[model samples]
Target: MALQRKDQDILNAMSLVESTKGELQKLRDNGWDSLMNKVSSFCEKHNAEMLVMEDVFVDPRKPRRKTNITNLHHYKVNCFYTILDLQLQEFNDRFTEVNTDLLICMASLSPLDSFCEFDKEKLVKLVKFYPDDFSYGETLCFEQHLDIYIDNVRRDERFKNLKSLGDLSCLMVKTQKHLAHPLVYRLLKMVLTLPVATASVERCFSAMKLVKTTTRNRIGDQFLSDCLVCYIEKELLDSVTNEKVIERFQMLNERRVVL
Candidate 1:
């Protein structure tokens, strides 16, 4: 969000606009090569130590007595390349050509760094990218808003140092100035709603340890979901004492049990 995506796009476009994708691909290829080289160096440095298997001195036919039966080869091929391949596939899937362009355009609405990095051209591309979402009049009106928004944001200290799009949305609401930049604020709201990262969702998996286990793995999906909700919000659950919990359980269907 702090990047000048418009300027970067324009700078890339300077060398024949059609070549930008090619250049980006080249950079990706170079990055992949660099990663492979690093992995190769690490493997070479530790090949003997990592790939060596323990000696098994007995034949399979004689393994009925004291013997170490082993089928693993000493020359183990690491699956680091497979991991890199999957990561590349995931990246390509999520960041198709059109999606990359859309994201670059969306960066125009970012409120980080006092809005000094906002670009009208990228904002215009964003409007054009989704014609149905934004009308012609609204996009045209955005030009006026863009200038006023930059001036207003630069002058106002309240708009500075926003950590994320969520912060930006809250600042917009707090200032009560959505009317000043309706299109930008709308885009801001949309960006705020986007699931940029899965850290919050990923945290739930850590919380899952509290409920699901080998001995109690028959939890239904709905029940597991309820458990996760409770697990994730432990601070609130901690506030409810044993008495309150017992009361709630007793209240379920006319006193189900006494805790």
Candidate 2:
């Protein structure tokens, strides 16, 4: 509760949320197979006979004939496995090849290994990923500058113990080489802003779900946007005093602030 709303603090909050969510998600990922097998065993205990199941979307329905009762468990098991299969398919559909490549490139930017990500090829791939964002000459220049930048900085005592991407960016800005390596700096800026914005946006959506549940779903867009801005930027909100609010409110009405 006392944490400042610094970028790293916000990131740490999001990371903690992610760590907990990930621990729970392992049950959904790796536990599914075993859990489904256990469900199959339960069906077997209920006299479900093994039958080859085909992948088809069929809702559970009452059997029309006596003979169909024998295959009831088959349908149930098929439905469960079919759902698991579809979930895996959906996961694949969401995390496409390009997204995976970009994530790998992001990992390479980590500074813990003494800024070891001086790889021209991986960074070239990163720049190439957003071809529209980089001019061809800038891309080539960045590709060349990467090696020079690391070699120029790595052996220096100041850069030896760096830990995170933010630390590296600060060092670069402190040294004022971000001007010299604009493209790389741009990429670093994107890397810094993207995840933080993504986390904040995701949290805002979750807050919106709470605020605008089905019963309250008619919230006006302007009100909703205003709520989100305040909610997402609560640290700033905390710093604002009630007198200031009253002052602003009175100014709107041309009266003394009552607070």
lDDT of each: 0.64, 0.67
- Global Cα lDDT for candidate 1: 0.64
Q: Top model by lDDT, which number?
A: 2
Residue 199 lDDT, candidate 1, scale 0-100: 44
Instruction: Give the alpha carbon lDDT tens digit for every residue of 1-259 in model 2.
Output: 3223334432244455445445545654576567658877988999986444443333357334343333335444555446656665554564445655665677566676686655668778888877778888888787777877767667677878887778889998998878877777789887776454454567778888877779878889999888878777888899999898877877777654454
